[model samples]
Target chain A: MATADSTSPCTEYIHIAYPVSPIDRVTWVDLPDALWHEILRFSAVQDLVRMERVCKKFNIQLDRKDRSHGAQEQGREREREREREQEQLSSIHDLWKTHCQHRWNDKPRYKLTDEREDWLRRHYDEHFATVDYGDTAGGATGRATGRATGSRTESSHVMMGNAAPFPVANTASSSPSTTSTPSLSKFSWKKTYFWMEQELARTTLTYDELESLDWYFNFTPLAGGRGKDTLLRCIFRHGLLSIGGAGFPSLPYRMLFLHPGDNPDIFSEQQVNATDQHSDTDTTTDATTDTETHDNPIFHGGIDTSQARRHNQEQAVLIADFPLHYVSRLHDSGEWLMTNAHVTFVSTDEAGALTYKDRNFQ
Target chain B: MADEGNGIIRLRSSDGKVFELTESAAEISELLKDSPREEDDEVTEIDIVRVASPCLEKVVEFMKHYDEEKMKEIPTPLGGSTFNEVMDQPWYQDFVSDEKMNRDMLFNMLSAANFLGIKPLLDLTCLKVTFQITGKNAEEIRELLRLPELTPEEEAKAREEHSWIFEEA
Candidate 1:
């Protein structure tokens, strides 16, 4: 890609020997170091690391180290110059901070006691432990069986593993710098950012696949024992679901009310309408409703004669009772992705029936 | 020279090629806008000794057609696989993707843009460069940038130190 043939029109300009510099032909490398820095600032962390390995110039440029052996007479001046260079290199903290802010904007903020510690790297290390929860020994087998059978049991195992207290000692063992000072200069935020991207990529399931599964079952038992609010908060805190804000449709409430034997399809449709009524009602009463719904054995019981009758009736109401606007709004939003779906509920009339506006749809 | 009545600004390139642009267009470049003009003279002329003619002409073309609102903001850590994917506007993509805009020309345009203090042009050019480097491996990057090969010892050291980065995902 770099070699330009003589026949190319670009060669016409290169061949012209400007009197100012005879031996040196202007090339990309000849651009000012500052301009190179500006261009490199646009590169992703992975690209930056790869670019650093391109050549010594890039290596030295990125490292910002002066390796020239100056005369002994200028020793003091060179020492001061090196100190300035060190200061400039350390200022890369601002760049990493920008990167962290952009990538994890929704993440909660924590106070740093030591200003010099590499926050981006440290965060990556900490978050890596939390996200890497289920994939240790039987994770592959669990995911495979879950995919084949859509088994709630397999998925619950993964969720149970997620609910286990984060191994604090694991953080120390995973990050070598925990014992060291973690000096900003030697630590590469670019590498940490690259690893973080890879981790996110690994954890992300295709929206369709996640939606098809009994996702509610993943947290149903936990939600029952821990209470819905704490479970919901834990899901957000653990970064298990990538969706942002409280506007994540009604998946949490749906999960809270659902049980092992309940037909998810029926509840999903019922909850879609229930979500409308739930949003309009006082949100403070949700905790009370949550307990009431869980206590009702009708939800936990397997499909029986009465349950089938109720399902048919609810299904009929869902099909016939949905307003024209609600149907249109549902069409506007693409498929409902259980993992990353964000829907804005808007009350359309004085009757307080709810419809959602999906930002992704627009 | 800029024709005062016609609102034309004249920019002389290093190779003695002169390009004329409207005052509004020329104002995109902070260097030309801030350049001192002889008050007694009827025309305004700026000398860009660092920028060659070809690069200057492209720079003039960019400034002439530049639109702040129309230009889509290129996201950082560019998520797109292709330049066209990253920038939806065909005009900006076509301008940079021109066959004549070789590696040398591209870098020269970047230099000219930086030298003339045209921030938008600079950013566009830099984004294009970033797109070129994205998703390429170390060896591919070295070849793309025409960088010299490191010694075996140095290569081994680099591999050892950053072994995790070198591993394929």
Candidate 2:
């Protein structure tokens, strides 16, 4: 065997060829569009689906296509989303229809104070003459502005109360003359708040509203007052209506305190925790009550009421005994001034001393 | 009114290109016979305005050869006799793939094959079209096709409008 690189004669000449293959180079465009479309129809469904999404040309062919299998969960999710949207739309419609239905009845009505009486009459009296066909005849003296006129079909009795500065619902004005415009449109918050305070003070006892208070609200009937449950009722807070009614006014339903802005929790957890410390009943001052219990016949027999109380007093001493020893040991070690000792840092001095400082309770 | 001979059709291209062929040759095109047509003295119209004069001459060349090959390639059990024979040859393939025959000649050949209902010629020419067009970028294609440039304002607006396309790219 001779190698081309080693022998000059063997490497003298060489021949190479690069033949072309025409049949090997073909693509979708090789076929007529109609035949290509038929081939597309016959393709394994996966390639057909991917091709349809790949370009606008394939998209055109996919216009009338239908799929027999797709993600079933995705279909269900879409249907559920559609249903949720429909429900929200219906709820909004119902809320709006409720407002519309109550148009004339319980319509947001207003009345005027002495300062405002003139302007309301001037703007509204002439147009409202035709509104209440009966006002012309019944001589009711007050006309409602946005309040209910004829809405009476629904089940709930829409009291038609004014949204703010609740008014006297009197409707009687037969005159056609225009009243002069008044100066002030806005009412003073102080005036309204004072008027509310005055109205609430008139109530001697408030108990019925207390019935509405949830457990979180401090509710107690005003002591030593007599009347209908509604009349003799006062809560220690206002704005109770928010639990089930109108806007939240800071003062609760009917608050009673020795002073204004006083804690509604006057007898609540704050008082209980503060006074509970004095309730140990095991203090040395009550030691005789504990010692005398053992000599009493009822304390041993557990039959007499006084003896039962004596026994309880002794039991309190027994329970409080252990926690106090640590207090006593701590005191002996360094004068136990702290019964509720909170230990922060434990350090001993070089002078052979154990130092305990009262930790200001955080 | 119904008197007729063995089926055959006469095709006339837009450039006064006349082709006479049997019914089967014309019928290979699904559209040729299915038309609810009323026969008239006038020759039928087939649009071939794009078939440039020189390429149309090549198109006629390819169709003449393709029809002859197709006749020999197909078989039928006619009159209780069957004949199956195939000639091993490179003449047909070489005629189609000759690089000296320009792209226009190939395009015209493909169009004429569709019109005259010749299948193999259509396949060969269409494949050449695909090879020429595929894998070309927009700029390269625009240059090859001699399209004009986008205005400066249009370029800016298109950048904004198709920003997402660039984002994916």
Candidate 3:
């Protein structure tokens, strides 16, 4: 692509009898190094590395740049120079970071969270592990229990694995005393497994595909064994589904829950006029809706939960219920995600009475 | 704030050559614009004394083509790949081709553009130099820029250290 053709009469002014300088041996070397860097600034990552091999002068520039990243290692005298160089390197790193994050638009990108940072640190070392209870014990029992009484508990004898035991307030309908009950012990300690790669964001769950699923099951389990309150707590701990930028789906992806067909249950469904619109909901999910309505079985709660936080929306959907029976509010916010969950007690009796519990964990 | 009627700016180059350009064309050089000048001054003389005469003359010629009125019509390329492609167009081709301006001349213009704060000229010159050396191997670039060759051992070490970038090539 290098060509030098005289485009205009401007060449008339060109001095042919100019005295040649001894420094003409390296014409580029005569230019200020900063101008060279400005030229290199437009170079691609691969080209930048390639330029290091150009000559000792260019190589030294690249070497200084590489060293500038770890400025802490430099001696005291060059500290200020290293800091300035570090600033330039960081701006480039920011561009690389944005490229890797898959940012597509001018929309405000999500900030990195401590949880995601920890996850990324572990990921680079291949140490990041997430226990997926849904694939093994939870999956088998979830299928065995059928639809109406979808709830199942793990035996307390089962090893908890890496998942440390946290206190759970059992709010099972059998004991409405508002006090801790003995049945809370019946909930089995679910074994947590370090997730293999395929389960991490891609196929495990599409954060934006909630409307298509019977009820979107993210990292939180649908069937809570103990109390509804504890289930809400577990959901709060785990339900904050990951947004984009930190992990996978590196595009401007979001679930626009404001669509007409997707009636977001921001408040109790009871608060809204109960129209006979159940058929429309069933039509959306089709056959899966029947099974989900009858059973409420916890599907795949895709394993890893990133840091979460509740922002702006006072009534964001945490735990989404089908046909507007329940709603969850943003109870808690972690650095990376915000979670809301709605837990409803299904009445097996013909009375058809249902209890709705809304909880927040901020 | 010089009078608009038939005004001209005289610029003295580093090699002691005096070149005259219309004030409209001279305005493209930020160095000329920032200097204090009286409205009654007939021919405003600005010393672009740091740039070589030939490069200063070339800058004047480029400014003549893209005077303030014409520059408004050319779209600025979006960054990255698009910017590179824009530099390869016919207009830029005629301006940056090696046959018209050799390596030393372009380098001279680059320094001149920098000193004068003529942004488009600076960018065009930088793009020309970048395209010349960007994809070429070290030996090829050394031949192009006429730099002394590295010793065999240094070449091998550089090759080894930067093998990752060479992998794609």
Candidate 4:
């Protein structure tokens, strides 16, 4: 808090006449080039990219000779003479290869023979371009139907459907890029690092991101439904379903679901019919209106207009008022196990806190 | 002075303040280990002209508590968001936390650590700096470091050249 010109209050009585020397107060800019390099060594790749924008000093420090020194002929000549031997030993390709290995150490190493490809950028694009959230229908439909059903069985289906295609689709998309590269020479590892960070921020939901959403579903169980559902609330965004309620653990449990494809009609006919019988005409019309607004293709199949009308009416009514006639049968039926969804549980620790656990999901 | 025969080394700061430490503790700094010793009264005294009293005091305190076995290795590309999560020792976390160390003092401590060739302190200070720089944009980083604003032309050119970084995901 003390400024360079302000003398310490403790030192005022001892040295009232003499002011503190300005040379003693050092700023970040005053640090020597050697110390700057030491600090740069500790920075991550994304930090290095942003540091270039901080000031010209950092920009010049982080700039590569090939990219930044086009007009400086004299400096380039000197640099060439100084780095002739070093450049031969460690090429730009080797430098980026080391970066790729360090950042994605867990990824399987590939023996690449192509010299023209920018392996680091390719690796980033392949791994992060599309974050698999399971099949599309599984995410969107599961959310809509789960809100309507409000049963533990439906919640399990939502998890299973959302988790099914994530790991499999991710691996499927990433493998082909390693072999196919025609325009990778234009990319740089530093840019790729920024892109990866951006993609990560987009896919992963922070506590703040969750709290900002206006719509959330609280599915309290109807009579005869097992367990107390008073505290359970679910928020779905970017194909991620976050479950948090009162008395739940401090960690917010999140499930990632990817593709939003066909709606498989996971709802049982008997449950749909029973709920439809209890719904009044006004609520049925409102449910139809809600379905029309979403315009989702998943709900269009396997139901006649009357059955669909009744189902929509039941869906419009809150889950608390709906009948739980099919709860026992759905629990014993094991119907949620239809998909091969590999559900990975992602839990955020505390508010605005990001840990290695979230990064692993990326 | 009783520990003069026990290999106690005396370090003199630029502002005429002297701090004493055992030779084992002093060995944490390569500069201290390699400094030419004075044989006055069978005690060693080395002058460090670059480090002032306040920075040297911190350096000496860190060296006194230096333990090779207990020191945790700081991870590269920092895996955790906060320094407390990354650093296992609470004492080490408190050493560089904002409550105890200000920006100027932290930079000065870094300079002193660098000048004295203390690798662990250097790494710890740099890690603290890296934590500050992480997850912050360029303007925020400039504000944190108290750097002056760039000229209008330079700012536009820099942004134009690195437009990808400025774009939202």
Candidate 5:
């Protein structure tokens, strides 16, 4: 608990000046107004906000750029992020498509045949609806259901015994014979929801040995205050998990996944070769070892550049004694928040029994 | 009407002196634009001897160049443009040369930045002043700004409010 690494640099800034030089040193109107104008134009709005506070002069309380500015700035950013995610999904689709249809190609495509097109689109719509930034249905792009409606079809295929010929959606459009098999019509439309649920279910982090990561920050989930404060404090006694974009306009996104008690440090497990890595081969891990085995959810895909919006890695995340939600809102303006998507927080259900209050030094 | 930029506007300094300039020159004060339209008439200047007439002249010069997009070439607080070269403008040198004149002007400029709510200009100007005032003791601060030396009681009040900085002697 009392490690040298745990305690070191402490930087806190406080500003106070008396009547003679209320802001101390100099004032702005004194500077040629031209100099002031130039300074305002170049900086990002966020940085300007902070620079403003340093002195009464700089505190230009710019009304947050009007709606148009926010749309132009933040909206455009959202669009770019969406595009990047789509591109990655498309690549993943290609692999699934090729391997299922024509293993011949080096890479496969997730062929959105006519039959599954609508279903797939619906699925996409539904999936995104429930995820982070929720509920507002996007403009229905005609391409949604028109693509892979076939594979995700509501109809069933005839299965001959255990080989339960799954209605693979990636049937090649080029393979004409593969289409219209009467055999496909003979079966029952079994709702694939069970399998689908299994596929889409997200495993909560720290299900196992991941508990050691508690040192990262006070990850307890609690809403700090009901009023002005809107900050989710990430407390840590020692280890620093620098979480988001840096300096002033920083937005943190990268998540540090943890689980409850598999060997949180699996890399040290000598008997087993890397079990949680690329190979899907099963290993016999006892309950204790299982805890150790899946300790940390290593981004097997590595640091995703596509996900590094706002320079995600630059943020510093620490463990506070409580959950981030417990900290008062840093900007809780009655806006509905979606976990990880809108400022950080977890509802009481997600992070049981945490007490945090909203407090601000300012 | 199109000559709104060239329209006439009047600015009265804190000590009841009025100077009429084109609307554009007056707009340089941002306080007008940012203030509630209804309150515009109330901003009639009181005295700001801290901003000397010579400094006002320089401010006008700055506004003239600034209106023509000159400020855009200068860096701002947002995008990290440290165009320090702009500070080297000859007049900037002369403005600071007569410390007494610039000192008063600097205070005015700071007040103007505050009134206008323009962060960058305020930051740059204030930062310049900080360098001028940094490390200087209270007596020097009062003398440099021409404020009369504070009476013991007044000095104590000021210190009490801002005890964050302490004299170790």
Candidate 6:
């Protein structure tokens, strides 16, 4: 009935019987590396990051596993991704083709200025051999570029009129080399453009390129351009050219200048959101024209003479609409803006009142 | 291979304590299964010198339930619980948490199971230890295992890297 603390004899017996703490007698550091790896294999992937922090040894083991996985599996993932991107591009190209045919049936050709001519000559001439091949042997240039060199290609289209009113089928396929490299390489033009603008102190862009650049200047309707659909302009903005073309230099300068980089929503939901946003903004501006929104009405309603005039007006409004909002924002800023597209951040006020969507939009 | 002629096998532990088990029981360990027989009449003595006497005894005791035919049928711990609920089974709870068997002895049992190539026992021991450490905070685990304290920077980095997991907690 006596407690050890109260009795001297009992306290002495307890002290002699238990010489050390139970935990002190047990060492767990002796567990082998194989056991650790087995445990890791069974652990959830989400737990790997935590397991890595256990010790330097664990960190090494986890990182080694990751590196081994990243090698072959990542390559397979990229292959699948490339195939998916190609499919998306082909579908978009179909949409683009349909849009172009309907909009530009009676479109006027782009008028070339001396400055614009020099600009276009420098960039496009080397790839298509536009000046030399269009004039001399179109089939020779087509064969050299691995195109259908028989008779009709981008060069042949150029040869037909030097300034074709509409972008032909071959122009879309042959202008941008799709099988060359991946999407990352297409943006190398930005690096090159910076060097030219900063070092050379001037731009010698062709008239077509200048016209492409102007496509970013005002808010233009996506489906309408005055007597011209600006197919070239649309291609660059939506990454139509960069979709399949890896190292293709056909990336227009306007795309580089105006791209809203890395909005995770951009390709899927944001694309829908952007189109919806465009329509919503347009509906507010032109309330009466909302019912006549379908620019390609020929594909819908039977041809009407009054509808023809409305279509032309819509094209002018479309071209005028595209660049105005973006240009005005830049103009209001009254200074040059440099964007990397990668390093984007959202900062909230101290009160934390804004939702994620609001802060993202801001 | 014939259970009728099979007799007791002698297992010599690291501390020289020998335990006798049926040849069928000894067959559970791959090490003893392939052990060369001196004679049909003589007892096959497998010197499992890597295992301590107490741990080897526990491993031998587990080998009784460890059916080699049903080796692949070790019950995987059911999910949703923090620790593998299989550790809570009556036999496992009593054996693994024995008064004399501290953390070191549990690990020794794990090492012995691994050495003997008795997979189910090895998994059982490993899962037992895994459960002990599973839900405990890093500091508690480090203290329990007598691990050296992490530097502030390492601790900070670990927290940052697994912040999602930490935030859930």
Q: lDDT for each of the candidates?
A: 0.46, 0.30, 0.41, 0.46, 0.31, 0.39
Q: lDDT tens digits, residues A141-210, model 1?
A: 2232343212223333343333211112233345545544444555544444433333222312222222
lDDT of 1 by residue, B14-108 (tens): 67688888777777777667655555544556556667788889989888888333466667766576778888887788889857577777877
How does the DockQ of candidate 6 come out?
Answer: 0.06
The segments of candidate 1 whose C-alpha lies over 4 angstroms from its true place after superposition are A1-25, A61-97, A109-188, A191-362, B1-6, B40-42, B67-70, B77-79, B164-169
lDDT per residue as tens, model 2, A89-174: 34323332222222212211222244223323343322222222222111111111222222221111111121111222222232
- Categorize the docking of model 4: incorrect
Score residue A251 of candidate 4 by CA lDDT. Answer: 30
Which one is best on DockQ? 1
Query: Residue by residue across A273-312, what tens digits does model 6's lDDT show?
Result: 2354454442323311322333222312212212111111
Candidate 5 residues lying further than 4 Å off, grouped into runs, are A1-362, B1-21, B30-50, B70-105, B112-169
Query: Candidate 2's residue-wise lDDT over B1-169, tens digit each?
Result: 1123224444434344555544444445544444222244233333233333455455555544554665233211111111111222355545655555654455446555564455655555544443343334334434433334555644444334233222222
Regarding TM-score, does 1 or 3 come out ahead?
Answer: 1
TM-score of each: 0.52, 0.24, 0.44, 0.48, 0.26, 0.38
Label model 6 with its docking quality class. incorrect
Q: Once model 1 is optimally superposed onto the true structure by TM-score, how far is the C-alpha of residue B15 displaced, in angstroms?
A: 1.2
Ranking by DockQ: 1, 4, 3, 6, 5, 2
Worst 10 residues of 2 chain B by lDDT: B75-84
Q: Candidate 2 lDDT (Cα, whole model)?
A: 0.30
**Best candidate per TM-score, number?**
1
Report fnat in order of the candidates.
0.34, 0.00, 0.26, 0.35, 0.06, 0.11
| Candidate 4's TM-score on the B chain | 0.87
**Can you give the lDDT of residue A200 in candidate 1?**
25
Over 4 Å off in model 6, which ranges?
A1-26, A44-48, A61-362, B1-5, B67-84, B87-89, B97-101, B151-169
